[model samples]
Target chain A: MASNLRSPLARVRGLGSAKDGTGHWWAQRLTALALIPLTLWFVAGVLGHVGADYAEVRAWIGHPVTAGLFLLLIGATFYHAALGVQVVIEDYVHNEWAKLASLLTVKAALLILGLAAALAVLSILFD
Target chain B: MSAQDEAASDPKARRPLSPHLQVYRPQLTSALSIFHRITGIALAVGTLLLVWWLVAAAAGPEAYAAASGFIGSWLGLFLLLGWSAALFYHLANGIRHLVWDAGYGFELPTVYASGWAVVIVTGALTLLAWIVGLVAW
Candidate 1:
């Protein structure tokens, strides 16, 4: 009962092609591209607000444009960081279960923290 | 056990392992590539500080003061300085990666040159940021 399905080359390659190739790679690069300008803007904005009081800092965050951009920065920075860290874990973590646990932890932390940061910005903007 | 199973379970089996860092002479290009990953992880962990500051600011003046106090302290300043440098290095090297993705800068000389540029740019940006921060404070 020989079923001729996959070609010899495909059979030889085995499960290597099962993974979502290039998606992670492309996502990492795309997020990096988005961060370039966002990071520069963030650095400049922080520098401009140096030595300011809490009220002044809150006021700065409360601005419509600044809050919007800050939200964008939070999202991109966390997402990019998660993707980058996932690769490091996958490469270095030898134990399969540990690797899975770590990957899950990193992603969960990023999601929770990203949401919290965004909410903080929103609260300031509305207050 | 079957021969196939025995072969699969054999400890002495020869399989391809990734080239270890010890095998290669450390070059600027290789060092920068490794540093890129290290800084990326640092930046990831450093995002917690950013989140804490934002939450504190949103919470109230007292919370904000507490957070700012820690950030203004010597140890906090040191960590922040390191974080800022990591951020800049990761950002610069990330741009170099984007260029590589665009199908350029693969030439050996160009790669090495870009690696050094990332290092120099990271240093300059970090120094400039600290200078501005200190002067403004």
Candidate 2:
């Protein structure tokens, strides 16, 4: 190797000089992994609604098991999107101020949308 | 006047550090960055479609029928196909990232090879999903 005399720690132990962040990378993947089965279930549930009437749709959501699954899907998906979008802004937005601003904006938007959707689903199933 | 001469300028200020993308030929790392960005945008827009589907389903039969009708259109089908591909690609790539985090694919050749693998696997899965979807219809 080019630096055979150096220890392996020298090559990797303190490489954070760039102030680089890894949480965003890790979180995105984690959430995606979580969403896999949830997403599949969601697609199937929607497919089940193909020709169902309004009451049928309502009744489906009203089922405790379905409502619980739907909520899990919503929460996981929005959280996943928020994490993914944060990384996108970090990679593309070169301007520091603009990057931070855009990141916050995406986070807030996802949070609001995710909560709103969850509430809507809950209200339907509950009342 | 009391300060010493500032003749000793910063030694590292002008020295070259690590090579950047500008210096190297395109590689998988660069390609991964681009792929991540594209997938991120796709996910964002795809979320809107999800929200719309939910709203329509929640609204009532007429609204759900209208939305589903639009979804049945050729344009809707095309978009759905694209979105499904995006979802699968992102999912496969996410697994790649996790593997990478644990430091398995760090070798130069392995990096590129796995990148190609990700692409191939994502396409295969997308096609599989569509095939399954067709059977359902």
Candidate 3:
């Protein structure tokens, strides 16, 4: 029982503490901080564009500021989501092999989707 | 005792599992904490819809129309409503967490107050968004 106590540093790093203590925790919080403004802007923008046609939506995304903010939103969102789901998996998935596999799979999938989303935004902006 | 000593003395002794959920009475703090994680997962799954909408919009009018058509359906609207609720709840609760991280709001009264605030604020925000969405549409 005494041996089970994690150091403060380990707790700060969250589940996996591979040298850089608090890195994962800080990343999660920082991304969450970033998302606050980005998500609000996105929600408001989407609401503003409700029922809009293709051209209207396309033009919105094509605007330089909109495109830049959206790209930032995409990157931050997917990265934060991956970090979050990773912790959830680590907590509930008891089997070691299954846990590792799921973590890797989530990371890969989010990476691909993030890139795809960025590409979609870029194509719209450029087109 | 040291690991080796314990192992030698009680070879069959193994690590015990932590207490399970059923063992404890549910409380607001615990419930809200669990909900935060649940909504986090929900939002992750909901991201697919966002990605699809973006890709469809980028693809062409035809693709955009298809995506919009589906999203306009009853089931799609229902899911979006739920997703919006989850998003707002997660957002509100996340701010609460940030507040906690700042080393305030740890008092029991404050914790419960913030928990209820999160719930109420989320409901209000979701309703507002949906109303605005419908009006805009």
- Candidate 2, overall lDDT? 0.75
Q: Look at candidate 2 and give me any clashing residue pairs.
A: none
Ranking of candidates on lDDT, top first: 3, 1, 2
Taking the tens digit of each residue's C-alpha lDDT, what string does model 3 give over A9-78? 5665665545556777889999999999999999999999998888999999999999999999999999
Q: Chain A of model 1, TM-score against the native?
A: 0.85
Q: Model 2: what TM-score?
A: 0.74
Q: Cα deviation in Å at residue B61, candidate 3?
A: 1.3
Rank the candidate models, highest DockQ first.
1, 3, 2
Predicted candidate 2 versus true structure: per-residue lDDT over B1-137, tens digit per residue? 22232322443345453546578787767787578669768877778777776777667678777877887789888999888888877777777877877779888888888888889988997887777677656
- Position B21, candidate 1: lDDT: 54
lDDT of 3: 0.91
Docking class for candidate 3: medium
Each candidate's number of clashing pairs is: 0, 0, 0
CA shift at B82, candidate 1, in angstroms?
A: 0.3
Model 1: lDDT of residue A126 = 94
TM-score of each: 0.89, 0.74, 0.89
Clashes of 3: 0
Off by over 4 Å in 1: A1-18, B1-16
Docking class of 2: acceptable
Local error of candidate 2 at residue B128 (angstroms): 1.9
lDDT of 1 by residue, A1-127 (tens): 1686777566545543536556677788888999999999999999999899988999999999999999999999999989989999988886788999999999999999999999999999999
